[model samples]
Target: MSQANEKTDWLHALLLYGLGFLLFWEWLRPLSIISDTGQSEIFILFTAFLFLLSYFQLPFWLSFPVKGIAMVYALHEMFFPGSFFDFLWLNYFLSDFSQNVGFLFDGRFDSLSNVFRTFLFFILLWLISYLMQYWLIQTRRIFLFLLVTIVYISVIDTFTTYEADQAIIRIVIIGFILLGLLQILRIQEQEGVSFSKGRFPVYWLMPLVVVIAFSSLFGYIAPKAEPQWPDPVPFLKKTTGDDGEGKNGNGISKIGYGEDDSQLGGPFVMDDTSVFTAQIKDRGYWRVETKDVYTGKGWESSVRDRVMFEGSTETLFEDDVEVEAFDMKMNMTGNEEFDFIVHPGQVTSIETGKDVQLLENPLTGKVFTQNLGESVVLDNYNLEYESPTFSEKMLREASTEYPERLADTYLQLPETLPERVGALAEEITSEEDNPYDKARAIENYFVGNGFVYETTDVAVPGENDDYVDQFLFETQLGYCDNFSSSMTVLLRSLGIPARWVKGFTEGEFVAAAGDYREYEVTNNNAHSWVEAYFPEVGWVPFEPTRGFSNQADFVSDYSDDEASNTETSDPAQAEEEQAQQQEQLPQEEAASGSSSAPFEWSMWYTVVLIVIFLLLCYVVLKNYKKWLKRLIISKYKKRDDDKALSEAYFRLLWLLDLHGIKRGANQTLREYAVQVDQKLRTKDMKELTRRYEENYYRGKTNNDGWDEMKKLWENLIKKMQS
Candidate 1:
């Protein structure tokens, strides 16, 4: 009986420890997403170690030293570089600890080092582990902890990017199972009943498991209602006065075109919501606006000038330039409405099926639709434009004599621009003679260099740091904005007339519509590039972004010579062929980008093993009680007569409880026996209870009427089973 009680206690401790570890793990999982915490695995292992010590019910004298050693080892693995017993690390640790202790006394929490902060976190876990044990064992209650865990996950899910969908599901299941088990234990304690050979009452557990499983499945499969209230994120931002416009705030903005270009550098999450679609014969960049001034951090227009035009015929380029006039239709997706028209190339005319006036900003090249002196949103519009194709001969032969107004306007730069930027520009364009070659040299410099195209991890410039200088000299990592802005600044530093351009790329092709191809443009296609003004060439587009090809046409001098050898004489056919060739380049570049790095098979193997181990644990935990009960029953049946009689009486009590014939706490042995006899319609329980009392209280364990006692026990067990 004592051994069975000890085993039951061990099993209970193990269950408590497992549940505690799971709850603690939920807390650590979001740290990496919401903060800069690293080496989370070490923290998880340390938590498991602490819970294991609690499970063993170790003495404080022994457990304290073991836990201390484990914490020191974990800290060493996470932060230290030398051997485990290195004196240098110990000395550094002691010095840092002293400094942090002073900081604590001074209330200077922000000045704490990583090592000292980690030590405090370890102590926190230690206290939490002790509290969990106390709640599980002494009070047999964990509702407060479960409630806090739910709140923690929900708050992070609301404020941060941590998706708590699976976490919420796991918590609900674990919490229900834990509450049910704790309730059973509480009842057992109240009734002064030990668990039957360390096995839970399977009948009680089965209903709990079935209900939880069915409810979870139904909840997952049921259709959810759409949110009736407006999203709280924008409301929260508005209350905080963070419009996310310009340099007023440092928050991440949604991916789309905005009027403000004063702040450009920061991480942005991808928004795949469709903006609009275009139907055109040829693919081209959709120009929105241009910024002439580089303020060392971001782009902004120096002039807020507007020019009203009557008709759609607005000539933006000189007559000497070569351009082809084409027509395209723009259809808004209705997901969002805009007052401005997104056009390809210079606009000549617009047909909106309404008598609306057009507002054009000559300085910024942005056009807006107005009705009755108020901005109007259009659902569909037809536009005519001239797509310019520049010749390499004209670009190479164009003189450096710049127009006074153009140079002053497009070559604007901040006074705080770094000096190293000009030097690097010179070094890169030294081999080139003409402006076109010089621009190409700077544009192609980012291709094979150490620069990387990343969106999320890009760094925002510090107060003392120039944005272009940081990307070029320090980080060398960013997305389209970084590459395009750097190229514009680099050109300005070299006395070249350049401006920053923002718009959407030629979007993914959907299907062919009569004579044109339809393209769907989403927010993900929002892009930026560089436009440098050349003599007699106007402002030509150049794509400096890695993994992207320039969509503008650039004809080589030998193109006419090669055209005679090809069968396709139509200019549109040639243009389509060139577009197809340019499209394939980006795919090839992206594929070759990771070809040099070898795959890590060990990582895959480790992930597979972890998944398998978790599944096995789930299976064993679900059905282990039944297996344990059967083993214990078989062992009891094979015992000697003196021991068998005592074991049989205990089994009888377990069977009565399992069959809902439980004895009340106030009932004595005789009263409980009479009640059980009445329930089973037999007099055997009275005889069995008398024999058990004789052996249990009177110290008479001689097994002298063992055959009759066995017969009575068998009869009662058979009646209960029936």
Candidate 2:
């Protein structure tokens, strides 16, 4: 073999083994490194072996599609969590720009840019590989080797973060292999290694078999799928002296109820995952709002609704329920559509609440709702959920009949306030309108003004009675919490029934399989909006924070297109500026735009595929000419008979073993055949045994013996099928 031929010969095998190992390594690593154990390690080893076997039979090119699909699915699950899978297809095409896309709500193009950029990057890399291979075929140099290695290492480290799951790791590994192959191809071309079409070899089947076997093994042994589920309850809110009934070290109360733990609010720990989930007929605030009278450690829900028994009436335990003109009904059924029912606090009455018959649960309060067809009366005398859970009375009640608790909260306001803040509120909203209109006007003012939205870093809360004044007049930026709190207090100061409501904004719905729409809620998605009570209109929500008004009419004022276009233009414009500077100087060298070192085909499979493809093409286009030249020049080009016999013997033995025939480790070919015939149960086995004997013991010199032996194996296959 020529020097060039020898140089590129090892690339295929080297890449195949390297990628197979990488796939296994990635699979062994768990989401959290702390979870890694012996089980994952053993599985990885087995999987790698299976892959090796599968690749031995299949073409390197064919294995990529299956692997690529699997990798993409796994990686997407790891990074984006809830929202990640919804836009998975975007990731496939826009890998390069994924990091810079920002949040979905930030801007549309900002999100999509990464995905598109990644896809473009991959394409460019592919093109580079093609060019590099074309160039490298003519020359090989030491600098080339070092450059290739350095580039490969840099690419892997830069793109493959620890958080990336097994699938993405596989992609990275496979990509490297493909690039490496192109480099090898380039080297081969440069070294002037020449070969005739007839001499070209095809090992596509070897890798194909190995990859298939590996994938199958992985699937069979893979662990059961586990869907992410929320913890049953939010982090325990308080660790008071443990009451004997309580399990934790806190003695506050036997029953875990009333308010969240009080020792220290865990900014990290979340509320009960299920707290936000309830089935309601209509969308509204989840009445977590509790503050008997704001004690200033942040407003909290003080009263706990007693859980009513199944099919009980609200009349049983009503102190007094607020009456309304129109009977309101809310129901909590099983985990169906709209799993959680959330409403404004101070809900004095219940009617048409489903599955809740009003029987009381001693522990959790107000668990059930009164079931009154479409309308139930609020026990106005007692003011329990629509008094008389099953009364036939058609009495019209005023919507303003609120419980004392509700009235007290609405009327509540901080004792101290900056004079300028109150003046500003009054100035923004005229006194001619009702409290509801005033509240709306104030909300509109805050949203319309130059107040910014973001979580504030401020620690001082009691600086002024009018927190809104401080925010508006002093600090300009605060998160949704700050914005909503300021608005709530201001509305209360103005005699409007305003309260802070905590819930998440609706996330984009992902219509996955069937009619199910998966909702992905994140910490970034948690939000607070202000609810202002109008005597006639009931309670209405208003988000006062700029760029995030809760009103439906509040459209995004920021332009996504402009933001993305401007961000994308910065680099291009900079390059253009540089080019202009260079243009002014007559003798200056033209500016070269930034170009990444081209990716060479590093994958063994891809290299193997390219090699096979080139071989096949050569065989088709120049086989006859090559054959003539070989016949006239090197007569030894034909494979050696001895080598062919050894190959045929080993192949036939492996084929027999595949059919369930056992072969002893130390048995020779002739000995194995004799053993096969003695144990043979069918004519096909006997024939196979005879063929092996003829090829091995009889020294059959006919060049066609290998062909005959192959025919016997085919017959055996047919017999097995029959």
Candidate 3:
């Protein structure tokens, strides 16, 4: 083999490895969007390492241990908190492995721990990396893998929030190049032509490269046609009866307040259409209704008993709560009308132009408007309500003793609810001694934890999955519904009376009226929150969503010492302090003139570290052959014998080939020696070839001045280097 052939092989291997990595990347990219599989970058690095080992043709005995160490490191980094050499991680891995084996036998896949699941994922990636290498190198066929990669990207792009526009372009470029190279290799093999004979196939590859580049650029700049077909996802869902309605009647719902709460989960699209506007001095959550019974999937009312009322109001809260009377007017804006009135706080009285009757569901606190035995949608209405502010001191000292009816209605959890949910709730609230603190702890858990506030790309629970359990442990990314529902269920699991309430957020501020502020509420403001019932303080609203702040006010009475100790205990006070800190941050930065200097330096520091790592890698890869040559020369120089002479002679031939000496496929050893002697202007190659032939082909063990032959081999290597 000549240097040209060796260079060609190295180039082909690098290209194949690159294409294979890109294909694997496509498979891993969707894990972050469609599921809870984080740490995709680590998986990508592991796959790249596997490909590197294969490219070097490392023996399994050496490579397997290296891969095992890498896998252990990845597991430790992702799931454990300890030193790399700590034995505790090993113990935990073994425990998870043993338990998962039992789960596998019982076919309880969902019960598997995340550590075991990640282990399985690593094993799967190992298998895939091996398969990719085999397809790229041994068989010189990757069409099936490429095709599957395209299909995978397409399906994920259509079904999830991931945009695959750039991915498609990348696949096209890589797929074409892979196919072209594989075809070149195939033609070379069939015709018995060495890559050295053609010198890298520039004539074959340049045209292929040109065609691919031109086509990709043209396709990118060309005007694309609109989608020819309607989206089939909805049609397919309807056909398969998966139209956001699960087996237990709980699945994805739309963004606005709807009459049905039977199904809830999955992603929803935002609707910015205006719903109504209110003229009021204060902003608060507009309550529509509450659901008491949680059916493992969603909320529903256990009873439908109705009580009729006139213009006056029904008692919504206890009399001990402090209240302030306020009057507001609501004007409907959207075409879609509803019979229920959206009111803030407890309604004291309602006045409308049309004669109407009000029927309220005591079980659900949903008030309906009726006129002449028929439900009516009021275009405009005046509401006089008393907004109650609960005393935090009273709530903290509130009794756990609940009325039987309230406990039975609010503390309802399905039998199928996972035990982990209750355990997690207890874990979150274990430090808090009072119900108020416990509720605040659970509510704030979502804000500081890894929970994400996302509207699209949310997962719908499977048939056997509980909605709250899925949100808490699996996909911690969702909108208000997920957070509120999970908190409510967690509260119920802890023997607290809580219900899920859905309504509108205080909408965007419009303008200031004469004595009040005018606000415009849109369907985009449709929200849900948790309401835990305190024995004496009534149902208090809690905002557990990641980005949303609770609007209800709480009055706390604390001594100076208590205030100092628990300054951040009040949610509203904490929010106010956070706001004050943010307001002061700019001033503080200006005064010090160095507040942002550390952050700026840290960014540059990270960039420099990354650049250094890449530069080191480049240096190692570029000079590795020279290092290997030095290592070989040092090893064989110490042994001066016939066997060492023969081995050193063959290694010299490889080195000479790397230095561009020609070796024809049909050439004998003497012929190759003549070519090397002509190139290096030395007769040392001929002498070494004669000695090698004598020792290897004739099986002669005579040393025959092996020292002289070693000198000749070293001389030939030195001349070739010059």
Candidate 4:
């Protein structure tokens, strides 16, 4: 091989393996695999293997389509959780700016940017892999760079991950594989190898496995350290920022609650992971953080002040506010440190095993606790709530006097909120006189309209879009957060004070003793509900979400109103009238964009199909020579024994040439066979040379035993290899 070809081969090998290293680092370092248990690592390994196989089958330039297609899918998954499978264009990202020809520079690409972003990501992965490979291989100084990178990531992962669940094992195994690939490339460079000539040698793989085995054994026996860094991941907030429940932890929550991702949040998935178990009576949802500030992205709890409370006191309800009182006790689980999931009512007194700091928003009665030490035994806590008794009759007549301070804090709205939100709120509450009626009107819109209440997959709002506005006027699909946050925003838009509250649901009533009821609350029961505050009535808990028909006396009010509307009408054709009214609501919902066009998913299966297709291509490339030889054997199979002898003789010559002992162009067949006999130090090819001369020049048929010639041919092949 020429020096230039050797240089290119080394570069190709370096780029191919080096890119694998970078991709592994980018994926593993930033994210925690504890929840996933190395799921992301498995995916990385699969993609890398697929990538290398493609490198072997196609020329470097065409390899992009093989990997780039999969990357586009990944990018789609990032922007919209449920949409990696959605294809062509999902109208959400097709904003005004992205339609231009420039693609990246104009910045108005909106959702369309995802396509370029993924393509650009693949390009970057491709370029950096090649660039690093070429630079390192050219300098013969590649291993040190990879070695430092491996150590850096190992140390970071060591210090960063909280659980550290078998991640080091993955890292160690990956290091061995990478080192093996690097050395294999160096070996190829030494041999001046070319792929088209024949099969690659497998001799280097033995040492690779041996080294990996020893390294893995050492890893198993290494001494462990008591981690001094934070127990929780440090860069967690950034990593989980996009698809996370901010305070609650990673993965989807089922009990229909999450950490304020959005009003119209990402896909709702059920996490059956048990969040906690609660023992209580007077079933009501737990209220933790009340997000008073609404950014288009999601809800934010602006109440950062922590009031240190001890003994029988915590700043909860104001003295003047009247409420019914009830005492209760419960324990919090260790899914994460308990940040206080309390009922909607105020805590009169509380106790805990760990020293706790109490934080409360008196106006909203939303409370939080900071645990001093990581306690595992569901630390026992007791508290009395100054709860309120409410009926639709009492709430409608209750005073709407706005406290100046309370009004400023509770009625907060995002400034970028569209005009349609306030307009729609007014339109819904046009016939209602009181704030209670107005709140009910907005809540009923979600329950009675064509809105869907789903826990696993919810509507994803567009960029620069207000979550509440999107939920109300556009896509009427979501879980508890969507329904509750929209109702709160609508209530605030109508001058009614409402806040989004999150915590566990009252939970399934497991067993009851005397006055109290025992309930089991899993992470699946994490729920969000709205608190619409009335001046004399205090903050009344409202279950605005459709599927959750409990935790409120007011939820049944809308059902009653629907029934009473017909009874009071005294119409002869009441059934027909009710059916007509129901039909009108869904029609209005459709006009308001409650249902979007059903997504026409491009053949997303094509990514998988393409992977399979490329794999088949690799298989064909790997075995093409063998298949071709079989074809040649069959072609000569029908002929006589002479042709078989000639075929065997030619194969020996080809093997010799493949092994770089090519016969000179000017050499006759006799001369070549004689030279091979000398190289083999045997008389094997001398008899074969005499037979070939007779067959070719004298046209003499070799009727003598062909087995003897075959043995000679086999010996010559073995000799040339040695």
Best by TM-score: 3
Q: Estimate each model's TM-score.
A: 0.52, 0.35, 0.54, 0.45
- Root-mean-square deviation (CA) per prediction: 15.4, 23.2, 11.5, 14.5
Predictions in order: lDDT: 0.77, 0.42, 0.77, 0.59
TM-score of candidate 1 against the unseen true structure: 0.52
* 422-455 per-residue lDDT for model 2 (tens digits): 6777787765354544655676665434454433
**Cα deviation of 513 in candidate 2 (Å)?**
16
Worst-scoring 10-residue span by lDDT in model 4: 566-575
lDDT of 3: 0.77
Misplaced by over 4 Å in model 2 are: 1-164, 167-175, 185-292, 295-297, 301-408, 416-424, 430-434, 446-480, 503-527, 535-538, 545-722
Pairing residues by index, what is the TM-score of model 4?
Answer: 0.45
Pairs in clash, predicted candidate 4? 93-111, 254-524, 255-524, 255-525, 255-526, 268-456, 275-523
Ranked candidates (TM-score, high to low): 3, 1, 4, 2
Better of 2 and 4 by lDDT: 4
How well is each residue in 615-702 modelled by candidate 4, as lDDT tens digits? Answer: 6886786566556555544554454565676676676677677656679989987787778777768887778888676666787666
